[model samples]
Target: MGFPKHLTSAIIRLELPKNDGGLILTKNLYLSCDPYMRSRMSRSTEGSYVDSFTPGSPISGNGVSRVLDSSLPGFKKGDLIWGVINWEEYSLIKDTSSLIKIQHIDVPLSYYTGILGMPGVTAYVGFYEICSPKKGDTVFVSAASGAVGQLVGQFAKLYGCYVVGSAGSKEKVDLLKNKFGFDEAFNYKEEQDLNAALKRYFPNGIDIYFENVGGKMLDEVLRNMRHHGRIAACGMITQYNLDQPEGIQNLFLIVAKRIRMEGFLVFDYCHLYPKFLEMILPLIHEGKITYVEDIVEGLENAPAALIGLYSGKNVGKQVVAIAHE
Candidate 1:
């Protein structure tokens, strides 16, 4: 069995509770199916940031929902919010601290599940805060066609940096170079020698490396970093499934290059969401920024959609659309 084996059945249904005491019942509109969710599928969530998904229990992740019934003071019925929500149609959220009420409806409601929500904030904090790029910096992004990487490449370009991205397939490489406007990009799977491939694109060495697929790619990247280069260690999908995580042979470069490598969680930067949205929404409105979502129509397909992430099946941001506005 892959990460999630249980068939998410269509028969499993739940409606909003008529009354809630110190809780809010909501109708889940969109569910985010991401690689990170696999960490929760394990029997134990030890060493994992989020709690594990208990078997036979409702699985929850970042979602956009409509408040149906509320016994809380700040929340009211019919209000729109996005936060940790269950895989089912309706859910009762007791700890309301993580939730955010949707303020801007001009954009698509489903955006709250991807670019406008956690993944957006993730890219924002990782690039601007962690990477600390300067104008004319040479940047590289691995797995660049996904929800987060595409935005990072665009952000680097907006900062007047030369960006190169890598993906597993030709279609994604084309998306990076042609659609996302990356100066250069390549299909990593096609390259026989990753180090030489990186050298071809980044002749002067990478000033900022957005670390997505970690393992072999990271090993090659460490060899090509400029002095004082920064690496924002995002999700390392390559090491996630391995029985023993691959060791990087060239970590000595960190000391030699004075590189700063950091890992971040979107929650720590939640306070900056408003600022992030302000910068992105205008770009979106002016048609300067664009996002793509591969949405599965119903909840039942969530299992397959989530597992497909590891296989690189979904094209863009993988969103499980539950209910419409």
Candidate 2:
């Protein structure tokens, strides 16, 4: 009945495979568990940018790794990198296209899997590119304590926007307000009427919405959006596992309010990685921006950590530590 049921681990001999060319061997330090990976678990990923996982093969995701051996010219031995890697202690990456060398190591190596890696870029592109935010804008973020959501809220606050976020628990709500510096935050689970909750937060109307949780929450957000408002559709974690996803009732409001709802993929905006790092790295060092991670140690426990995202078990970004470098 749960995602954990579908996952099983097996042990193989600690041996290296013959590298013909363009392959790099790595010792995976940390693995990321993202909500989007749930879609990749399906047998068919018709139009998805990412391929479906092979039934009996290792599930791959973004991770921080130390290169042990390399047949590629760009990567050398002991070069730290972050990119698509397998869910194991060691991985032989056949595709070197996705990998990026990590130049900055002052921060935790595990941070390459969250704050300094994919989620960080996602927040950057989704907010800055997709949602054209301005100062004094009323911004709302759903699932705001998660990897991308937390960063989006903080970015909005730093940009002089009035930010509010909704999470599943009081602990995460408090983290959003007190830690991430959101103007206000509330627990969506405790709200009887989501539309009323949005009304309470934004009496005028929402100018920008960083959507992570879709379904009822999105429908409510549509009704409370201001004219010419923008919405960055980041992820719909609520609909990932459903056979029939819920439909939004207020989509008609998109036309009525002149709402700009756009969906984005991190890969599309990868050319801006340097720009993102330039902005985020300084904030991180100056302590102007903060990140929270719910890391579970050991590769064997990775399945449980990934499954925890759906039930709101993780308080922040969920990461699996395979081996520290």
Candidate 3:
């Protein structure tokens, strides 16, 4: 166990460890910087599903890596895999539970950290399953240009839904409407009243809300939901770093409008990964779906890359490039 403290970038040199038969040694290729990781930085993760990071130790998150040597069964040298791996250059993995061997390389390998991996699965399960989206429904997404939110907007658009999204900047707002094919997008920071902004984009009222950000935004979305609308609570990036989470004043609207808001964790739905890939891989190949990544080179810059996510410094999926395969 390690004490919790504010995040700071540091590098420590260590000699290569002798890999025992049970361990799989890997050279990390890419690491994902996601908003959910902030919760792990806290000293006590009381309500968080994931465990807190041990301070002064190598923190781990979703990463793409290639196996160099493996003595573990079901894994061998030269296998490309993605899952939870250490932030360091070389990791001797003892836990194989989260590891998934990559079967497709036709797409960019760095995508495993974003659209093709956890974020992909997250967007799939949240929109299709939790939201029960119907064609022609009006949809709104928060943090719209991010890893998971981008995919959710595209998915809703493909499903024939009228899609709108909210991002933090003009650049991201442009990307959502121009690049991601969103019906409309707004820079939330520029909006004095989010409720009015949402109403302007969704005059018919939102039928589905892909919630990546919470706090004041959620309070407004609740007020804008139509009867029997669905809300998929994928993440609440705004509240992760706060000493106390904000309250939603319009939660009563959920009952008044007969809305259904469900929170989900992607890990619990991993069984659907095969189904998700079957649907998404074709979309990627046909250019029906597009993914953007903000790649930061080297392990030393990983901390800043992760920190950038909270401040909306990243334009898309933030990835730290550690090594080339």
Candidate 4:
């Protein structure tokens, strides 16, 4: 209701594990601050994919780490890996199965916490798997300057689609148009009416929507969607903090417009990680795809960095760099 508090920092002593039945001890390098984490700060209902972070507990999220010790098969000391780890300096990862041993270290390791990790997968699956497109499809992305949204727009462009994106500030909108090469970009905050803005951008009606911010944006999008338009509901950042969620009065457009709206979790698409890396790594190196990261230096700034996400304070992917090596 008032100001919210997320875990900041704590001092914890670490010990090398005795046995190695696939248990790995790693030093945390970088951690991710994402919109979904906000939902965990509150009490979630049954069947939620992730559980709420308990108070006084070391909060866990996607991170890139250097293996300090690993008695497990296929893992060894000094191997760089990225996966789920606690928000701490050193972490003892018990289950190494889900961990991704870093293959390409040429790119920034902190990228593993962002563009090369969970957020990247979310954009890939949501756009490619869910929002199947043909050339010249009229695409729109909400929160377009974000980590995932930026990638989505670029992916659509590379696939030969005309893309438009909406952000909250002039700077982000500029990044979308100039840096990301979106056909058009707008600051949603400056718009008096969202539906009018969508219409202004998509005069022919939008064919695909890569949704990041939901609620009113979704409702406005529904009104301007073309027949058989596809909506990839990646996240609802706008509704995450509201005590009462904003109801979409235009949901009936799903039937009227014959629209396909689908929601997906990145975990379900983990099997495609190798495939994703194959596609993104090449593009990243070739300069065909570009990524932006907003990283803070220390764990002490982690809480503010994370909380800043809600207000769109960060320009791109938000990361916390806990250590150098």
Each candidate's lDDT (Cα)? 0.87, 0.90, 0.89, 0.89
Error of 4 at 113 (Å): 1.5
Ten contiguous residues minimizing lDDT sum, candidate 1: 9-18
The collision pairs in model 3 are: none
Q: Report backbone clashes per prediction.
A: 0, 0, 0, 0
Per-model RMSD to reference: 2.1, 1.9, 2.6, 1.9
lDDT of 3 by residue, 160-220 (tens): 9999999999999999989999999999999999989998998889899999989999999
Estimated TM-score for each candidate: 0.94, 0.95, 0.94, 0.95
Q: Write the per-residue lDDT of candidate 1 for residues 1-325, one digit (tens) a residue.
A: 1366565545523434456458787888999987787777665556688888877777788999998878888999999999888888877788988899999999999899888999898999999999999999999998788989999999999899999999988898888888889999999989999999999999999999999889999999999999999999988977777778899999999999999999888878889999999999999899887887889888878888988888788777899988785
**Positional deviation of residue 32's Cα in model 1 after best superposition, in angstroms:** 0.5
lDDT of 2 at 279: 93
lDDT of 2 by residue, 210-324 (tens): 9999999999999999999999999999998888889888899999899999999998988999998999999999999999999999888899999899989999999999887
Q: Model 1: residues >4 Å from true position, as ranges? A: 7-19, 43-46
Compared with the true structure, the alpha-carbon lDDT of candidate 3 equals 0.89
RMSD value for candidate 4: 1.9
Model 2 has an lDDT value of 0.90
